[model samples]
Target: MILQLIQVSKSFGDHQVLDDIDFELKEPQIIGLVAPNGYGKTTLFNIISNLEKPDHGEIMIFSEKNTNEKIFEHLAYLQDNRVLYDNLTAREHLAFVAACHNVEQQEIIEICDRLGMSHYLDKRVKKYSLGMKQHLLLAIALISQPQLLLLDEPLNGLDPSSVKLFREIMTELFNKGVSIIISSHNLYEIEKLTSNILFLHDQKLIRNTEIDVPVDYFYFLSDIRKIETELTKNGFFWQSKNSVEFLFTLNECQKEKLEEICQSNDVLIYDCIQKISKTEAAYFSLFT
Candidate 1:
């Protein structure tokens, strides 16, 4: 195990945040931490980083080589609220981080180049965009070479291409035996990045199970794509509606064939989210 939390607890005033939290980190795996905001996910990261003392319980790890000597040495956390010197140029910032850790200047430059941060290295940190800042932070984290890397919503504010690139980098890192722990609510991101889910509900882990994408009716998606052509060719009696999500009424045989096609395409029907119905749920979570 890389890291373990045994029955951890924390509170402020009368409000309890983390309640008897127990979890472990295994190497060569990417763990997804999913939960509502203000549910103590970040708080737990703080505790693990030794930023705050736990009220009770223990964070235990097996004694390994150089493990106890630097309990935090193997842990690197990129908090949601990013930290950077506003006055420093991006290159200066990277250099400063490298100096702090005694990383070679050549290695720092190589890391910046590899991450596509070279062009903006000379730009002032305050002028850097969110994506650039995130890249810089990730570079710093990688330089430290922590066995366990914890990121809080790393994909926030990134463009689609950047998100895709970041996912690729994460996959590459995991392949190299780096354990990643990320907290995100974006199911699409989770579905793409992880095989198991650490489903957090009400500040306690309700489940940690394999992420199963429910099977979708196979031919349904194909039929929808070629609806006009298929309609004229098959001469089937059916109805269609497009108020919001795609809707169709097909007879038994058509429905069966559609299911078969969709299943073959790895489309999961039950995972489809109906946004109109979920609008209320979204509003309450955001405003209430």
Candidate 2:
């Protein structure tokens, strides 16, 4: 196993963050850590990285208790850009991480090139834009060639092209047997990356797999009661958003039945939108 957590719990005085969280990662696959802001996603990452201790639990990395610093050699964490030094250039920062990992200078250059940082690698971090800084942070994370990578909001401030590049690199690393856990608010991108999801809700962890199920449809209708009655009578799963809005999960035949009901009853659907992927559907079902 790559990582295991047993009865992990944490709190800040009266506010409990995580409660009895148990998880195990046994293979090299990309998993998305999902939760709203201030929900202890970062706290869990910190505990796994050994930056913070769980109030009540045991953590093991690489089949060993996370007590020795040498075990960290196979792990890398890509946190925020605050770890960067404004006075130094990107090359300098990469060199520091390379030296720590015994990586060669040539490999640093190759990584910079791969991440499109060779253009401004010599420029000071103080003058870098948010996207540029994000690229630099990614470079620092890749410098060590770790077996396990923990990325907290790595997609922040990245443009579309940069995001594409980041996804490509992550896929390459996963193909090489590197386990990755990434947290992002972009549910669409998360769906594209992986189907294995770890959700933090109600101070506990919920694991979901094979999330690419049927699409969910959200409809704003003129007659909510009629639609609700029809859906319930037909044995379709649905949730009422409000007086006018309703969300439904329907199969092909169920969808045709819904269309027939609307047409027969003259229920005008003012607006209709589909939750393109199950990831967004799951997010809304869990949190909203």
Candidate 3:
């Protein structure tokens, strides 16, 4: 494994952000961290980067304990534009990172070209747009060629073209055996990147698998009140009921059972829709 966390916990006085979270990742893999704002996604990244000491437990990178100095050598974390010096041009920023990592200048230029950042790399960061800044941040992370890459909201303000470019670069890096962990609010983009997802909820880590498969069946019943008890008794939770009808999320097995229940209860089926991706439904299922 490239990264592992064992019983990690962190708290800030009244708020217990992370609670005994255990996670592991292998090399050359891309994992998505999905959560809402203030859900300790950033806190987890900080702990991995050794910016904040965990209240309890341990973090291991490449089987070595993650430390402050060692992380700078083997890890590259792209947090936000605040890390950028507004007065420095993109080239200057890249050069500074390259110097710290002992990367050659020509290699930095090549990375810029590959990421399509050569157009505005010479302009000061203050004058660059959000997309341009995102490009710079990604380029800086790539310059070090880090064995473990941690990206927090990397695609936040990128345009369509830049988003496509970022995905391409991420794929290239993954192909080269760079283990990456990305935290993003973009569910669709996350689905496109990887199926392995770690969801943080109620100060705990929930590993959600099979996120790549689209839900095969979604059923809406015309008379939900007639079979509400039977549905819940069978361990199937129906969605909202504000509409005249009710929607129930189900899988292939549940669909078969639902058909039998509907037949017995005489519940009229209004619609059956096939979904393209289950990421959204899976996300909301955590809350509901």
Q: Which candidate has the top score in lDDT?
A: 2
- Summarize candidate 3's per-residue lDDT along 1-288 as a digit string, tens digits: 788999999999989999998887865788889988778999999899898899999999887898737766778999889999999999999888999889999999899998788888889899988888888898888888898999999998899888888888888888988888999867789888898788888888776764332254556677777877988899987666555444566665777798889889988877777665566767877754
Backbone clash pairs in model 3 (N, Cα, C under 3 Å; residues 3+ apart or in different chains), count? 0
Error of 2 at 182 (Å): 0.2
Error of 3 at 16 (Å): 0.9
lDDT of 2 by residue, 178-261 (tens): 999998766778778998888788898877553334567997889867666766787877788998888887645677788788
Candidates' C-alpha lDDT: 0.66, 0.86, 0.83
- Number of the candidate with higher TM-score, 1 or 3: 3
Judged by lDDT against the true structure, how good is candidate 3?
Answer: 0.83
Q: Model 2: clashing residue pairs?
A: none
**Global fold similarity of model 3 (TM-score):** 0.80
> Total clashing residue pairs per candidate?
9, 0, 0
Model 2 lDDT at residue 266:
88
Candidate 1 Cα misplacement greater than 4 A, ranges: 61-69, 208-288
Q: Which residue pairs overlap in candidate 3's backbone?
A: none
Candidate 1 local lDDT, 1-288, one digit each (tens): 787887888888888888898977665688877666777778877777777778987775433422244665666778753578888887787677678677898888888887888888888888878888888778877776677788877887788887888889889888988888888766567658885557555556543432222221212232344344444465544334342234433434655655555566555444232232222233233324
Q: What TM-score would each prediction reach against the true structure?
A: 0.70, 0.81, 0.80
